[model samples]
Target: MTYYRTYENKEDVVIQFLKTRTDRLLKQFDEGNYQNRYEWYKEIFEEILEQKEITYKILKTPQLCAVALEHFNNFAKVLLPRVYKIEGDSTAMHNRIIYQTGGFVFLMSHWVLDGCRQSPEEMAHLLDGYIHNQ
Candidate 1:
């Protein structure tokens, strides 16, 4: 099934999708009502399946969870340098590094609101250049 585009390209659609879903997941995780990370991810992935206009064939819940986790994990790894750069110039917040996964979650919340405006692949490339050792 073809998912119609409101954005310029498939990349744009994916970027928007990631921003939206990540924002929701971040919020739910922050609320602390969920028992564990997998449970939280399960709920968010179910919501994505229900609400998003996805073109991929349906899969089992575990499969959906796997996909979501992989995407978010890649995003976190690629974006880590940017987060470190932001924090490096400041002295106000250090927790972002202490718990890297949580830091990524918080950063993703800002991404949805602030808008990265770059595609994920672009961000990953920029990250590689910025970090050098990655």
Candidate 2:
């Protein structure tokens, strides 16, 4: 029941898209902490995108890419298993990202989304369907 959402990148900087909702997602960014390591996270997302160029195959097939894009909710998980949830599964989170490029779009959730809490992989799968078929 993840209350998923999707939006076009509409910009070159990935952070802009991510920042689109930092206010609601992050507890500190509003306090100005995001600025401290903003560049780092942005670079990380960009680097992962570049290293996984093979994934771009989805872009060509918008049908498939659209399916995978649904997993966008896992964006929070991108930095999950973070300092707070250090004991959880990070690799699991990694498997959740929905890779896209340009003014690319992805998904996200309203805290707790659909009442039924979701795993990173589950989120990815939902998007995968759209990415592969749509």
Candidate 3:
């Protein structure tokens, strides 16, 4: 709290924290080279699982859930195109990205809420299956 004294409210603090965390993950994703998108997803899932407590708290909180979803949306927008060939009508592409991102977040939220019963590798494989089938 003291470190974030500049923020006027809790929402602001959460937003800033999410932005920073998302930025770091994006940077790592961008810098790393992987044989496939699954590898990238696995790495990210591992990182998130390491912080499951905090993530669960954020997802459970109504206001913070919105913030988390927004950041996840932004993160997906930047990361997805790099791994997939996303080309089409502008509106259609945007909607596709939103759905894809939302689905991924939904899976993650449920996984965290359910105590992350699946390992990160398993989660990545599941997500890969979804993406591959699409």
Top model number, TM-score: 3
For 17-116, candidate 3 gives per-residue lDDT tens digits of: 7788778867876776777779878987898898899888898899989877887888777876765667543777688789889889999989999999
lDDT, candidate 3, at 94: 80
Can you write out model 2's per-residue Cα lDDT over 43-81, one digit (the tens) per residue? 333433443443444434555455444434454444334
Screening candidate 3 with a backbone cut-off below 3 angstroms (N, C-alpha, C), the clashing residue pairs are: none
lDDT tens per residue, model 1, 16-89:
67678666766665576676444554464355435433523212244543454456666554444453445343
Off by over 4 Å in 2: 1-35, 76-134
As a TM-score, model 2 comes out at 0.27
The lDDT of model 1 is 0.48
Off by over 4 Å in 1: 1-6, 51-74, 78-134
Rank the candidate models, highest TM-score first. Answer: 3, 1, 2
